[model samples]
Target: MAIAPQWEAALQAVQSPPAQRRPGRPRATGHPTDRYEAKRKAILDAAARLFTLRGYEATSVRDISREAGISQATLYHYTGSKPEILAAIHNLMADELLPRMNGILQSDLSPERKLAEYMRAEMELIERHPTYTAAMRHKRWLLPGAAQEMREKRDEADRILDAILQEGIDKGVFHPFNVKFARLAIMGMSNYIGTWFSPVGPSTIPEIADGFARILLQGLLSASPHR
Candidate 1:
């Protein structure tokens, strides 16, 4: 996924090379920055898994340290505090996801296409990173510092969805359904995938996304409602 302008620091940290190695040394396996970023990503992935399985409140720095195969002090060097790690997990996802959703809101696609594409994009993200998705969804209100702005971004997403639904109504592609309720229905249906989606499952993410979209766009009744 293209990096969103919202958070450039992590991407920069990974991309920027650090020229730090003694001339006579054995090259230290790779670039120092690459090593740093790889280790950091591992730490975050470990934390995401633990946060998803053990729950954030029950997990600790020591657990993350052990999971990452590093000392507590070393974990601190990569990620300052537990809260910061949590914030980073959420921030990274937001950086990759929110921009795409925002773009969909402004895309030239028809309303039906927009909603379907939006659902697929979102489900694909969740399917790709189910651990982080579940971890972030759990205790979403626990964000600290500037990360609290995530709540605002989430609210903005809500407005974007509402506008898309409104566009469908205005364009005569959909009946004038209650936007709030429709939004809730779709959001609930999409989010539940985090709990049950499996790579080996009978359905792929695109299939699940398309199926859910079809259910919303077309009623369950294949013919007239049977009384």
Candidate 2:
């Protein structure tokens, strides 16, 4: 997957060295904590890129270390194991979606509007973080605990969507449908976008999101015969 412009800028920024210290006193390398955070972010960026290009199961610690341009020891100092890194990436994807989804759910908007906003947010997320979405699709099976945590977060997101759908049904704004299946259909559609969406494609994220929301709320069948 092509790296987004912002990610490209971030990778370059982290690779650049700190400013030279003044000659008079002692050389400074900035704060140790800042250096550690930069290195950690770099590792995650590399891991997400590699995991997107190569299957997560096939990527090794050595691969990540090399991609990050750090020694194996240095990589280990930041992230202990490959699975741990994968877990972090999974959490990162979840963190990006959860807060926005929760806010939409908690808002005073009507159910249909809430669902539309949620769909837009989700589509935008997939557009911005395709690599993370791809990595999540090919999850590592070895980490059961980590997998369970991710599943729980996913379920919570689904519940919020389901609640909105149910509210729509109750209010007669939407057809009565199985909320669980509706939620699954919406999520499955959004998830599949990672496989084909292009940053430089003709359609923008909002365009895609609007099309999806329209399809979800209105069936594709023509309402009348052609004139």
Candidate 3:
């Protein structure tokens, strides 16, 4: 089966991971004491770089195994395939990111303020781990189980945003729009940052977050201040 050209980049990128951090139930709150987690992270980082530089199909498990200083058997023990590695990378990101978002959602800040915080956190995470961003763009055609799992988690994030937007609309603080579409547009804009935005660039992550929030708050249509 052939993937579309536009989707190919992302499919290969998914061989890396998403730009966002993953969230989940916390097991041990502290960092790993052993070298296992550290080695795993190093492998993932190296794989991300390799996948980005060379197409996924062109990059082999032997390449990652060699780059990570681990044996092919060890790499297989950690992750079965490229897609599985991508899924694991995303799971790691979500585990780091979602808990923070959940905390923000629980805070006393106004809906608008919460949204701004979420955007900032999101952009910062993307800046740190951009491979995840590329993977997300080509998520649809990924290995079925892992891809669906990722989609469900992503939907959870959207639900959080949707709730915030709904709250603002109820309080007459936000412009009314189709909730699903608005959420998609907002998230789509944020998720694509890996393709163009760079953490080392002149424009800082905070600036990008601020700009996105500003656009979300102020639509292109002129508004009446009198209202």
Candidate 4:
């Protein structure tokens, strides 16, 4: 399946050879990766907040450092550069998201159930890390190197979704439609949760996921193409 047209330029840029990396401080602990991961998470979380608050282009390293409650040099100690930081935010999402996608794909559940679970998993991740999800959702402005590196990590979800959708379509479980558009539409609806959804508000993630899945399936299961 084709990616959305608007990302073509960004895709082309990513196909080229990527630049080399600037290594950060070596891992300090022998077993517990959490210390390093936690620090990285802190930097990434701070960057996510800044990235979403101010546009990625407008947000600066200094802003991220300040938001993260660290000196600029300390920030660099945890992260290499701005693009790397942005990439880390998305990578963090991908790291959490892909496994759930895989699990849903592999399950014996019906397409509708699989999809409902997918939404639950995605929104749960988003709810846990809303700014991070929002930053990744709205921004695609990474360097060629970072972008190239991230392509597979990010696209893995789409790949799984395509497989699921195609399988459902083949089995006549879901109505025939453009798989790419369907994927985009489903993801588009969920990604917006970062902006409007609130944990303390009326709807919970599971409820929202079920609601969204029901709404989408209503259209997917529609008998008439004219609708």
Considering every candidate listed, which one attains the maximal TM-score?
Answer: 2
Off by over 4 Å in 1: 1-35, 140-147, 219-227
Q: Candidate 3: deviation at residue 164, Å? A: 1.0
* lDDT for 223 (candidate 2): 39
Question: Which digits, one per residue and each the tens of the lDDT, describe model 2 over residues 124-188?
Answer: 88766666666676675538999899889988898888888877776677766777888888888
lDDT of 1 by residue, 13-132 (tens): 323222233455354788899998888988888887777667888889998887777778978999889888888787777778788888999999877778877888788887667667
Task: Give the lDDT of residue 201 in candidate 1.
Answer: 64
**Shift in Å, residue 102, candidate 3:** 1.6
CA shift of 24, model 3, Å? 37
Could you tell me which residue pairs clash in candidate 2? none
lDDT over C-alpha atoms for residue 111 of model 4: 81
Ranking by TM-score: 2, 1, 3, 4
**Number of the candidate with higher lDDT, 1 or 2:** 2
C-alpha lDDT of all candidate models, in order: 0.73, 0.74, 0.68, 0.75
Decreasing lDDT order of the candidates:
4, 2, 1, 3
Residue 61, candidate 2: Cα error in Å is 0.7
lDDT of 4 at 62: 91
RMSD of each: 9.1, 5.9, 8.5, 10.4
* Best of the two (1, 3) by lDDT: 1
Worst 10 residues of 2 by lDDT: 218-227
Q: Write model 4 residue lDDT over 1-227, tens digit each, in one string.
A: 23233333433432333223346865566656778677777778777766665668878999877776677897898897988888777777788888888999999988878888988888899777656665775446887877876787758888888888777777677899999999999988887676567556788889999999999888776364321
Candidate 3 vs. true structure, TM-score: 0.77
